[model samples]
Target chain A: MSANEEAARHREVRNAWALSAPALILLLVAAIGPLFIMLVYSFLTPGQYGNVEWKFSWDAWIGTLYSRDIFDGTLKLADAHLTIFWRSVKLSLLTTIITFIVGFPTAWFIATRSPRSRALWLFLITIPFWTNLLIRTFAINEIIRNEGLINSVLMWMGVIDQPINMIYTDTAVFVGMTYVYLPLMVLPLFASIDRFDMRLLEAGYDLYASRWQVLRRVIVPIVRPGIVAGSILVFIPALGAYVTPRILGGGKNMMIGNFIELQFGQGRNWPLGAALSVLLLIVVTIALMFYVRASTKGTNNG
Target chain B: MTTDVAVEARNAVKAFGQGETAVRALDDVSIQIRKAEFFTLLGPSGCGKTTLLRLIAGFETPTSGQILLDGKDITNDPPNKRPVNTVFQSYALFPHLSVAQNIAFGLEMLGRPRAEITKTVERMLALVKLEAMAGRKTSQLSGGQQQRVALARALAPQPKVLLLDEPLSALDYKLRKEMQLELKRLQTETGITFIFVTHDQEEALTMSDRIAVMSAGHIQQIGGPREIYTRPVNRFVADFIGETNFLSGEAGEGRVTLASGDVVQVEGAEGRKGKVTVVIRPEQVRLAEAGAAETIPATVESLVYFGTDTHCHLRLKDGTEMVARLQSPASGEAGLQQGQSVGLRFAPGAARVLED
Candidate 1:
């Protein structure tokens, strides 16, 4: 509008940028820089030994979906690659759903405790986090293994002649992932449910809604942001999870993370590894975008 | 159990926490709300007015009593099973729903036909005069509009009775007055037995057809607005309903002898003796020149100038303090001075005697 006001506004913008410059520079160097390097390598040629070459090629990107035969040089669909991708997506979705089923009631319980004991309940929820993730995964392995506690107790009771072969399978991975990612779901759900107005329950009941209807129609809709947050928190990490699948799946079953790691280590294809890593990042980004959309829509309607 | 009685609470006692720490919130209270009447539970906070209302709504079960709806026992029925709804103190409209959806919620829960629900929601929106805000979220509304949506939502189900739990307390003064009239009109138009709960005496006096004055978990009195204001049965009801002067004296033959050797006529002291309390409303006391006939001599203590009336604070010879509301002249003050001698006269049949 005026020259003085314009100058002052310009100074404010400059000051804001100056204040944020450090964080912006750190993000670029620490986070986006490696991702940019991976993107560039995905477009380049793969070397004989385990790195990218200067020469450019689309072999790595093409190899992601279609594998070229070594002798015939004929292209065909990469069934193994497709299977790993499908398993990754499926297991991650199941993990999200299972964690939600177990976590919603847990969060509700913790949120409904009296003020003095609510803190204790929340502390108990986070007790598993005190230990390392790998250690916890191993602890789970100890229980469901062939000679683990469950099998030993059942065998001692003479109910089964043989121990169940639960280890080294998809079920093992699912159990381990659900165990590991459950707190992720519960914490956000707790945060939302704790802020929920208990009086709305009375209002819902007064409105002729059954208890089931109240939960589905009132409580779930109000706490939906927590559901979305918890789902994202579990789903994105579960999609690209490496440690649990590696330990629990026992090398026979592999997810996208192990497959990507195999390309760089044993397969010696750095470009393909980079391409797969970038693809996983894209999937996580899309999930986060949906989260943003859903959360914003929730607030707008709420 | 009469057909005219829409809801009845028979000797209801509600206690919170047990084993010696128990506090009786409603101590063996009984009340009958007639059909299509605007009955109010009025008292200060912790007087168990809300507890009584909750008992009727089936939110809180009585410890050892029965609640009835049209002569049917509903004591053990849950809130949802009862054909009643509540407009909460906070106007607890669902935040995620539009105004129209909030109104349609009860009908949908009751499994009404889709067309009927649509029609009822439309009519409710018009009843509260929020037709344009049907699509707006409850959070997007102002306090008064949210209040209307709460009303519409509760009324949409067409319950036999509507329980309002201090619903107007959240509104501002101007809006509270507007909604008071709006609530009265809604009750009249719907012809639903409205059980309203409030602490504000003025609100209860203005809106309710019958007021139940409560104190310390007991129903002190229940009567029409005029009856409760003019003919309170006890000191608590008289002091609680409005501003009043309480004078302790000996009563006999329709006359009271004050402690300071003055005599005054009280209407209800006939054939009574010994100690009693005289209840006289401020507006019923008229100030006149000193030493007038059939008057009590008093000294002016202070004068508060209200826009419509001037409150004259006075002290009697027996050290009893009293207030008289004098109408201010249109163009001037009431012309009363502090510390001046005056005579106080009670209007004919204005004073009632209560047991001390």
Candidate 2:
């Protein structure tokens, strides 16, 4: 702590802040600004023609899980919206679990390859994203449709009498979502597993542990941070996913994002849509907080 | 001829890659590890000693030849199927498991009863003197503590053979010295065949029952510490194990002739009549005052002082360079200054004349 060194450290801190201030200001304007506007709009009333009336009201908050019954001047729980929300939550959880089950080994394969082949495997994992995700979602049709590649091949081989109805089903939606978001799960897992010290696995083997025990007791526990990170990456995006469900789900099994879109589009209720958006954000934030707490607890115990 | 050999490698060969880029990591190596012996494979880096150790541990299969454990062929056995364990150089304890859990891992893998596992883990914790730290995370341990954990975890399973890969190399000098004795004590008590690998000559000398000296993926010699140091079969083993002064000369029956036409009498010349190199350790070349009988004439160059001794560097009449360690400052000719004439004496059978 010489005086000159202290002055230099202060200068470094000042320079760092100076370099970072522009990005901070940009985030405040672009990201936080919209959220603030949305929050205020959720408290405002909607005018006759889908415009914000700019007056304060709690009616929009009340309308999030309720719809007005014009005959009785009373509120009733919006069963359709609740069902959509619940379905979105369930599908998101399922997607996270499936992605993890598949991603863990995929990440391990990438992480354990020779340095020359590791880059190639990672590149192959991300190849699905070469085309736009929307196009890839549509490509599923060529495989799952009645006259698509799968049905044609199956009938030509005489394995099936008719094409199975896969489109607009929950299975199709899950398949589409899993394929689209798999890289999201794998990248974080790879980052963590790659940094793991492989000697621990060797030690496990030397101690007479089977390959399964090594993975269960050694590899999985060490890479838990990656699992948590990958789960978060898949779960949050899958919860708000509207594109895959709209196209693959045939608008039949609507996610929360589709519900929100309906509120702003055909439903023409701007205030209710804003309020629903706020509710989704609140739910995601609470879930994230719970995850963060649990992960911290895990680290503390470890 | 009939000692109970625990581990044996017969003409093992290991090669990596193919075509023009191929490399032989182990070249036609064979060894016998006796039961309950502290055997060390000593060599410099890239000398294939560690590879040989891994082969015995069942981590690597030989490209050719057979490995036997207690007279049973185990070359085809996977690592987990073999009754051998290793204390890795990195001491790869699971970062998530506590010290006791790490020691208990092998027993659990064997499907041992719960009471037996607990008792064995408690004994291991006591053996490593880590009982007070049983619940502590391995990540929280010091290097020495973690090393003990690795040793305890490997030894807990009571394997027939234990492999240690440069286990003490990562510790500080004081800790290494202490653990060397500790390891030897543990081996004596357990009566397990210990195969230790290291490049340090002193470590091999201090700890091993016998040392296998290797260089460039080839074994040069295998013998007890005294035998290996006193009678190295080749130049590589002589140069690697300790400091030596080489004299180029021609060997006759009990005599040798220097390049400068000076004749020196020596025993064990192998009765040959070609060029040879006589290797002598520094301490074995005794330095005395000039005009001593049966001593070679030499001029003192410098007396380099070590704490307990002085190395008297000198040149003989035939211009052969030599160094002799004097154990006492008051020893003969030790007080001689630079350029003083002194007579150098070789102890009986101290100098070994090797065929070049």
Candidate 3:
């Protein structure tokens, strides 16, 4: 390489690092800093009145997996923690599936719109992101409650004798999550599907493929990276969800988010909360790994 | 309505948008393609050739027309139900599927048995000479390889007719030439009607059994390649296909009086008088001694040697320009030089008379 070209390349590398330094420093302070603290404190004993003690402790990790008969050293399943984890997983999985079912068609409609109107449709998709999540969940609360718009209309139409108990149920939680996270799914789905060549659809039809076969065999496989990316985006947040389940699932329903909050607030077990937070972070990391693998697999195949 | 008429369009009209924004893409166009023949729609870009092909493929519905396949009205039928397939210009092979799987897709769409699909896919792979790359993804193949895979995939179902929409326009010149001959061979071997669309006049002339030359959403002429080249019906056909020297004059009794008041005899001008455009092929105009029977007086303007032949640019006494393509040996022996006056002779019927 020439000296001039080498010097110019070094300048580019320096420029990249200079641009990245601010974000790197902010992440170290805001995210990794707290995470390191949590990891360290998970191994320390809980002091009285919600503080960490310097003394060593194994009880927090032990409490995550099992309950103890200290005398016999025999282990039993800790259904208390396990139930919340399983509930979180189920809720997130259901939310991801339902969001995809609704988001795919909406994304397709937006992607196929005329270029002039595409911006308007995409703007509508992002309107929800402009509002506060807490407000959106509570706004949904009014509609699903007794004497709300749906039940009032249904009863007025003679479909029901009285207002149904739609609030304070798992159905409300499912609905809330799907509503809030739909835009997340739609954005990525739009990016992938929008870049797709519409001529391929015509080619599929010309080659005698049925509509369903085209969607299944051609469209879905091509947009799969977007689906996986959106799954991680929606599922991870919904798994650790706290506000919607509390507001719409109505406090009677508890998720992993509420459990971790209770450990630090009412239960006052700092070490256990830190350990549970670490575990949740681990689950999220695995989800991120899956996203990386899926994206890289796309490039390797190309 | 005959059985030999593979595909026919009657007065097809396609208009996009409405009111002020409306553009008529195909204006009352009609043509018939014969069965088992290599037919081509030849035109420049935006001449509505692709739109016509799309109408036949069921991608677009004509505003007013009847499209028939083997005497069956299929204007409203969906593409999936039609007895036709296409090799797309982009070669839209499924990126996620292997080349073999791409070839098998149409067969599977037809609900063919798995064993039959496998056998047909194998045969098609070998036919396109992509057998060694059968298991590779479509994206892994080169542009030429992918084009062949697309051809194999579209041809696997053995449709009654195949629509190729400029399928060779994307490749480099070398690959395009190779694929052009390859596609011709494929069409001949399969004995299926192939309607190819292209903007290339050379490709159309080289590969088509019959060429439909379109312009401004209307078909200007349709005939065998040789006939279209040799005997164009209008000035547009003459100017578009190849080089021609247009001589405008007053015609009468198989002759024209040049503007310089020199009487010249020409073919295809019988019983016609008044102003007309006479298109003469460069190769047909012969040069001899300064004065000869059935010849006109002209001066050599310039000479451009292209190895095997030399194009002698000439100007007649009336200030009309013409070009004559002369072979190297004969033109050299004639001792023709720039600024030299000579007699230009043409055989009977070598010139065509057309309305300006």
Candidate 4:
């Protein structure tokens, strides 16, 4: 090739690399580097001098597998971590299911409205998300506590003999988490439902399909993508949450977030803490993979 | 009760809003669609054509009317309980279902056995010539394919009457022409009463056995295509169906005299003598030599050359403008030029006298 042709090709390659360098480096630092650090820490052991050592060994993994007495006696191996993990999973699952049950009807109502009314409803849904997450959790706490609004109202109505034990329980955690993530579940589903064409429902009715049949066969399938997207939004955050559960669970009935906190805080066993973090990441990763596959199949078939 | 009328709307009065702002969409409109015939409601936009279609489909209830299908009064019935199906303009196919499942949806709603639903869906897919795409997603299909899938889905239920609301306007020009013939063929093969609503005059004229031309919540005329085109009942019908040269004149004893000093003989001229519009089709006007008996001297104003015929815009000395169609092959008018003088004539019954 001529010198000019060679120089043009080199310029094209240089420009392409230049344009992609920022994004590539950001990905490496924000995502890839932390994951590499976590993987290394997972294989490391606590040093004799009260710090993590760089020497690689499978001792942490083996200890987790075989040290039944120390791990189980302390209730962190199978019972404690497993219970916390399952609790987190259940809480997230319930949040997702409840959000869908509520969000679908809410989105349908909003979608059928006039443009001005729909805009107003959208503004209302977003107003709660504007405040800080801790503030919202605390607000929930104040409302359900001993001297809170429900107790005050019950006492005034003379229904209860004394203030009910309302705060610091699993129910409290569920309420706070659901409140925080309800909008997250609603917005995406609303987007999908809002774009739904009403003519299809009309067509369904004309074809002798009952209202229930139309909802089952047409509406649900068409809005599944939005449902999947919203479910993921609610499920992932509820799974890894520390603030809402910490405030609402009141430290006694702790979830995985508190377990992770105690291990790294007062417990001071960084290797076990790293292992638990790694386990949480693995669970989330598997779930995200399944979600991606299901969403892809839905779009492909549709 | 034993009559064979597939669908009938009796004095249907559908109004929107209330008080002064109310629009009577269908004002005492009545129509009977015979069994297994292709009936078309042809009108311009905002003429209540779609409203009428919705009323018959049971999507909307009329203010005061009785809708009967198969001799059963279905005036207050919901759409799901009616023995009718509609193909929407947008098709509205279930985006998440395959073509086979989309076609089988109604049968599934009816609680048909899975095997029966499958067999019927497959047959419908073949009928619409979309069996190969039965497994494909609706988005993967073309516009015409979606239209056929919609047709198959609606037809699989075998309703008493089928409604189509401008189903072909979404297609391209060539595909729409092809689908028009396919739709007619489907109607013949299935023997289903089709009530189609469209604003396209050509589509209505070509496909419908009988057409109701509606305007402003009123049906201007209802007849066969030829009769509606030739014998329009009023000036609105005449002007809406096709182009007509409206020569305002005074009617007298068996003759009408134009303001431009031209006179023409017409039938039924003695009944109304004040004023009338002489409706003449472009092709009916004959170009002849300057000395014919009924000929009037005219000057060619403009010449438009169509592929098959040439349209000559003429202006008489009395300031009446008229158009005549001449068969010309060449690009330039053969032996005709703007500003040239000629004589225009027509047969005795060429023009239809109409009330404005």
Best lDDT among the predictions, by candidate number: 1
Question: Per the 3 Å backbone cut-off, how many clashing residue pairs does candidate 2 have?
Answer: 0
lDDT of 3 by residue, A76-193 (tens): 9888778778878898999999999999999999999999999999999999989999999989998999978899899999999978999988888889999999999999999999
lDDT of 4 by residue, A158-267 (tens): 99979998798888888888889999989999999988888888988887888887787778778888888999999998898899889988987677777777766876
Model 3 regions lying over 4 Å from their true place = A1-29, A65-76, A147-162, A287-302, B1-3, B19-22, B289-293, B329-338
Model 2 residue A234 lDDT?
Answer: 96
Models 1 onward score TM values of 0.96, 0.89, 0.89, 0.92
RMSD of each: 2.1, 3.4, 3.6, 3.2
**Per-residue lDDT over B243-288 for candidate 3, one digit per residue giving the tens place of the 0 to 100 score:** 8988888888778876656666777788888998888899998999
Worst 10 residues of 4 chain A by lDDT: A59-68
Docking quality category of candidate 4 according to DockQ thresholds? medium
Task: Let me know the TM-score candidate 2 reaches against the reference structure.
Answer: 0.89
Rank candidates, lDDT, best first.
1, 3, 2, 4
Worst 10-residue lDDT window, candidate 2 chain A: A293-302
By DockQ, highest first, what's the ranking? 1, 4, 2, 3
Which rank order by TM-score, best down to worst?
1, 4, 3, 2
lDDT of each: 0.92, 0.88, 0.89, 0.85
The recovered share of true contacts, given per candidate in order, is: 0.89, 0.78, 0.78, 0.87
